[model samples]
Target: MSANSSGVVKVGVIQQANTADTDANLAKSIAQIRVAAARGAALVVLQELHRGLYFCQQEDVDQFDLAEPIPGPSTQVLGQLAKELNIVIVASLFEKRATGLHHNTAVVLERDGSIAGKYRKMHIPDDPGFYEKFYFTPGDLGFQPIETSVGKLGILVCWDQWFPEAARLMAMAGAELLIYPTAIGWNPQDEQAEKDRQRDAWTTVQRAHAIANGVPVVSVNRVGHEADPAGGAGLDFWGSSFVAGPQGEFLYRASIDQEETQVVDIDLGRSEDVRRIWPYLRDRRIDHYGDLLKIYRD
Candidate 1:
């Protein structure tokens, strides 16, 4: 409802760190969301795993306890808030789909406090510090856009942001915007130069997606250092959450170490104007892209 007929929408992004206290984290998110609503945001996005600390730093059986049903308590609370504010809310969570089956999921709450849709993270990474494969089942749901009151949302999770195919699939399916609820950062062992490369690469690729698809991109990330539960050096989550326009222009960018809520107004109608000039979609060589389905050209 915050979006007018002219394709102008005010979207909000919440970037904050989490702790062991899940209740406090949710409360903090709620308060920030209210602040965004006060700023006239029609849509609000939260960072990945906002419910608690980044538990994936180590593989522990107890971490499974954090997973809850999609329509469970978190949605109930967030949905109620969305209904009260008459806005759309997109939240990322650790989903307990079934016994012995869990997935990292992003749930979208409609203006009426109903479950609009959910996207289970497809790319589950098993890297050293990010041991997500231990906890999440690779998402079965294919790349698809969820229709909301404001527009069609292409919601992806933390690691999924790295893949162009995921973004393309969503954009192809008529998504108005690409959204990433992320939890990424640096390990203490990494050098400053390495960290810079990683973070810059992260932002650059997403901006490319916006330019290619002629749609805005929104990325929300947590900020601060989350320690490894296994008593090792932890990750310093660089919370440089940002929003970019269709031409890959920066709309709003957050600081690396602060908890913040920002509302940015975007003219969604501008995508059409941009696409008319660039016409990337019209020129795609679909016949030559069959090889993209393969793991590698070799």
Candidate 2:
């Protein structure tokens, strides 16, 4: 949107399994980032909470120890990498704000190894397996795009991907691409049919975002199965990280159960082309949407 014409840009998506070892996980993420840069990726995205296991499976107060400050350890390492590779990196981490204050935040590093901008996850899930409300305070920052050297990135976390309003706001604000750093999985004990439905629904909703907004969508999800520390049935993370074109076509999609790194080239200019044919934004009826503000219109 910022005078960037339609051109091919190589985007990287990483899907990896995580363990309880914080140091080990960080090391793995750093290594894959370098691999992506080597493969000519201009911008690379890591999965949600890549620095450690999905501790939200069972929230214990002590799990707060996993959080770190924004400019803290993870940024230092990733920022330096962004500078060395001269590539934009979108990294997600659990942020420790203050005494009993924390957030699930995504940080974007510039090409010069500086903090470009950050997005606190707006929607926090509180299901039985995902007790995120116990750990993260709902993000105070509104839905906004983070400007980077490459383009204006509409960054959202795992749960935020399900909401159309979140994606629409970012697109309305001139975001060039919708990027999601996600970590979602079903209970392994669920029926196979149920698992298929859950995954399909997740994929369909994101593609709908692309089709409606006429912008490309990039989603990076974690791989492998992480057991629940609470001793309940663990979740098997379906590793289907993918990138969709402005028309909701799959540019690239990783395996469903493998640690994968893929770079997909996309035309940033396609949004303009697609909008010319299907101009949903031009025909919106904002006057009739006032009831959307009410929690329940009885």
Candidate 3:
């Protein structure tokens, strides 16, 4: 796809905490989207599950009630807003595919208020307070990019951000930009040093993706703390939503402790120049990488 009429495009990310009330969370996200659009953002991306609190902190059968169909309420509301504002919108949802099936899906709304494509989260993490396997099924949609008026979006969810293969496939598929709508945070029980290390690693890995793929990356994570309703200490979501250029330079970064809506201009044309100089894609050793599909080489 060719670059927009101008060589630059403005993208925005919403990094705000969610409340237990789904309606309230949706309203907050809508308000932030309006703010971003008012400030000249052509494309706006929201944090993962922006409609409610991070329910995956602890598995509860009742949490399943939160899941809805793709064309359900959340998309209807956001789709209208996308058309009214005339901007591309990316939203993450808890999808209720059928009675017994569900997925952690991300939906892209085109500038004219139509569904572009969806990507189900492939990597589902199950850890201490985070018990996701009990909730979401693994995504069946392969690493495909969603083409839109702005560009091709390589959309991935929280845990999917950690895998180089996911990012690599998206780039090889011709994704102009990579996006992660994440909900990661610090374990309240962990020491300050460990928290810092975890946060730094998260940012570093995403930056490396941009450098390797020759595409800009936009990551939006929620802010503030949400308690673990099952009993233990909750997670303090570190809101360091950021944007990085194809060469891995920072374009915009939000604070770790505050709720913010910011727009950053990206030079889509830069990717062509970066790829020409650093031809990582052209030099790939494809013939020797057949083992990448194996679970283990043993």
Cα deviation of 172, candidate 3, in Å: 0.5
Q: 290, model 3: CA deviation in Å?
A: 0.8
List runs of model 1 lying over 4 Å from the truth: 1-5
Count of clashes in candidate 3: 0
lDDT of 1 by residue, 259-294 (tens): 999999988888878888999889999999999889
Candidate 2's TM-score: 0.98
For model 3 the local lDDT of residue 116 reads 90
Location of the lowest summed lDDT over 10 successive residues in candidate 1: 1-10
CA shift at 275, candidate 1, in angstroms?
Answer: 0.7
Q: Rank the candidates by TM-score, best first.
A: 2, 3, 1
lDDT of 2 by residue, 1-298 (tens): 2623677779989999999898999899889988999999999999999988999988798898889999998999999999999999999999999979999999999999999999999999999889999999999889989988788899999999999999999999988999999999989999999999999999999999999999999999998888888799988999899999888999988888999988889899988889999998999899999998998989
Q: All candidates' lDDT scores?
A: 0.93, 0.92, 0.93
TM-score attained by model 3: 0.98
Q: lDDT per residue, candidate 3, 93-212, as tens digits?
A: 999999989999999998888899999999999997778999999999999999998888999998999999999999999888999999999998999999999999999999999999
